[model samples]
Target chain A: MLKSAKMVMERARELAAKRRPVVAIAGAEDDDVLRAVSEAVRAGIVGATLVGQEVRIHALLEELGEDRNSFEIVNAENPKAVIALSVELCSSGRAQILMKGKVSTPDLMKAVLSPRAGLKVGKLLSHCAVLEATGYHKLLSITDGGVLSNPDFNDKLAIVENAVHVSRVIGVAEPKVGLLGVMNEPDPDFPSTIEAAAVARSCYVKGMTKYIEGPLTMGTIFRQMPEGATWKSDVVGDADILVAHSIEEANIAVKALINLRGAIFMGVITGAKVPLSLVSRADPPENKLASLALAAVISGASK
Target chain B: MTFQELQTRAQHIRPARMDVVGATPFEISIIEKWEKRGWKVRYREGELEHCLQAAVDAAACGETDLLFCSGADNLKLIRFLDRAVSRDYKPLTMLQGFEVPSYPKVLWVGFTPMARYDSIPDAIKGVSVVAKSMAELGEPEARIALLSCVELISPGVHSTIWEATLAHMSQRGQFGKARVDGPLAFDLAVSPQAVSNKGFKSEIHGQADVVIPPDLNSFCTLTDEIHLTGPHTAVGIVVGGPCPIALPPHRDERHMTLSLQVASLLV
Candidate 1:
């Protein structure tokens, strides 16, 4: 069972009390970025590395009652340089995990995957978001919002496998995975719909992913799923995760939850040797804090 | 006509050489019997295990010539089988019961449609009824849901038949064996008494194994009518697995014993 976001953050604070989380905040420039950094440092979740403009960071830290002397500030001149230094800090064991600040997600992601500057182990890198639905019983997850668009069936398999790993980390032994689509069963004329159903069936048959449903519509998901029970495929209602058909769909769905469904989303990248936290500007304050804490837990989990 | 011709002419078609994989007591019994007759058989009995791989291995080793399992496992096996078949692995068959195997001509009933019938709890209830009744009679059966005059969509009465069918299937110790087809229009399914009264040689007249009426009311009326109006007999056994989960017939103490005997050969 995945702890609530608040619980995860609290756990991180407890862990940090014993030993500080050495988080390297790359490209720390935005106000939201400063607020998160201040909160993390205040909570002791990060024994901080404030990369990017040093003067502005110190000014912001002083205002938050955080002392500049308590943490190190690296004055990297540009976004690329900051990313390079951040990766170097992580690779060299100076930082336990890399936390994205004001930098664009793709730019930091590129640095992380780059041969010289990033952490790339040569498997698929995917985005997995841990979501807490208001009415649902447990934390659910959805994937590929931060990376990969229009993945073929094999890619979807890898995504599911990757997501399953995150579920295990989040503490679900056999998470019920519902493959999202327009309908549960395919209309033969719609090739994509048919392909989606085929993929769901394939995963079920391969015994690769636990419970799976496909081509499922929203009607069944929000309205019709039997309350308080788990359903496999054909509209697994209020799924732990909403796997999208493409990044476009994923982005739309995630945004909808944030904008419409009122959900708290924490994003991470799996399928790497080390789990990475990739935050966004639009993310609520709680989600940003949760993402960093999750990173710390997953990073220290191995060590 | 030969058996093959008769089989082909039948509206419903099923894949032969059914491979019974997965181990429940039922499947194990099914394999035991088929192997005893010297028919090649392969089985894997474990959690989320692959009988297809074993089946393929058996095929390669010349130990078995056919493979069988409930079509529920089709998607799971299809990809591997597709790869195996593409690599010249011998093509295996998908066994379907009470269906034409192809779409348009066949409609699969039972719990298989639960995914599509989420909104309709009544449909599920109907299946439960069928499963329970059949269980009382002793059968290893999948709950069969009946559709209405509508050809493909499952109606509420399906749950009724399904519960009875499932009971029968389980009692007989088989999983996918009970042949439950239904809601077939009276003209096509049963005596065609209504249609013949209007004069015609019906496609499925007098040959229907199960007839689904429009609603619960119609369903009860028809069952009573069939028994009262004609000399009719029903002997249903769950077929997909080893033991026939069946309700022991009132007249035959031998039926259950015979079912167990056949089940013994399966393992």
Candidate 2:
């Protein structure tokens, strides 16, 4: 029901005030990350636990004109230890959300996927970017852009489920999922079309028919449906989630929507025990704040 | 339509004065047919080297504004005329099929080497010129579809990126007097049923006046598929210059006459 990113932030603020999820930041020396975390703390959205060098964290806090004792800082020796401690904080019920700060994504992911001290919940970890542009009627979610390379049938299913979970936490009761493909029909030459049809069939057989539709195009989801068409689906032109076949497809579409269409978005890694706030280094401070808000809301709902 | 009817339509826009050069006897006889329909037709006798001189002479006389070339083999003359008229010249081809009953007319463009457009800006430039020429030829508000394998702009798929960029540019008023929609496949570009079934909402959906492919290779393959496999009539016109130059496939009388009729509107 949240039509814009502003509404998403408003809903997240309301949920955070009710639950007050504790957010653990791994490699938390980045200024943009601290800015967003500080804003969320000021709004009473979430409490933060910073995991990094104590001296650097204190310096950043002072540089941002905040009191040194306002936040909890965990001193760690290296990036690996920082990620391990943050994951431990989330797994031990000390923190509700895990976020990546200045560390590389692969390094953070390695720690999160580590069997001994990871946040895996026996599901595939996929990335979902939630976007709200001017022309769209509601917020749109594109999934598996940053994590999965070439997702198979099961990976796509998990990706869709993860996106649906996030959408539900953000207030959409039943998210309409669109399995994106080149065309509607299943062509022998195109493997994506075949996979799309298989995914659609899987969703149908699993009694999740009301939640998904595909082999659809981006235009069918963003623009008006073709006039006088007999095909029946609720996802066309009103899709809450778009499940792409590959990382390249999802990444290109997401980047184009953000870069070309001027869409505001928040990126997160889902399908974990707790939602992970993961964003690109090029993302603005507002986007990082929105990601924090998103993590807070999803974490609160998961409880 | 008949030559007389074509001349009448041409008169509505502008009176066409044509200068023909380096054509076969059969080609000249076709222009003679237009002469019978009250068209001002002048035939200049020239070999390959004399083509540029002949076109310049025709233009200098102020009697002929449009120059019709014999075939694509006269690249030197096409280049010379292209430079003489305008700096930007894009060759536009119209693929007409009577055998396939569903979709009749499709404009396949940017196939010629002289009209090779690779980047986004060049593709948009070519499409804008062709769309404007189509509008002047009587179809106002031409629907242009940027052809690709799919509608989504995926990485490693350069055509889809170019198509998305052109569509964005068109949305931002970069291409004038054209309703452009793209990254569309061939089915969605031409078939109304495909457009309806796919649930695509676009101005050019199922009703495209011009179809600009991603590059020259795809355009060649598409044109060949339609020409060899199906019974169809295809003709090429180089626009975006001061005048339209026809680049017909063959030197046959039918093609030359049809190309001349098309060039008359732009001239």
Best by lDDT: 2
lDDT of 2 by residue, A104-173 (tens): 7778777777787657884789999898865667888888767875577888888887888888877788
Alpha-carbon lDDT of model 1: 0.52
Q: What lDDT tens digits, residue by residue, belong to model 1 across residues B144-219?
A: 3233322222333343344344334434544234444433333233323423443433333434323333232222
Candidate models: Cα lDDT each: 0.52, 0.69
Worst 10 residues of 2 chain A by lDDT: A252-261
After the best TM-score superposition of candidate 1, give how far the Cα of residue B210 lies from its true spot, in angstroms: 51
Give, for candidate 2 chain B, the lowest lDDT window spanning 10 residues.
B92-101
DockQ of every candidate: 0.01, 0.03
For model 1, what is the error of residue A303's alpha carbon versus the real structure, in angstroms, after optimal superposition?
3.0
Error of 2 at B126 (Å): 16
What's model 1's lDDT at A6?
76
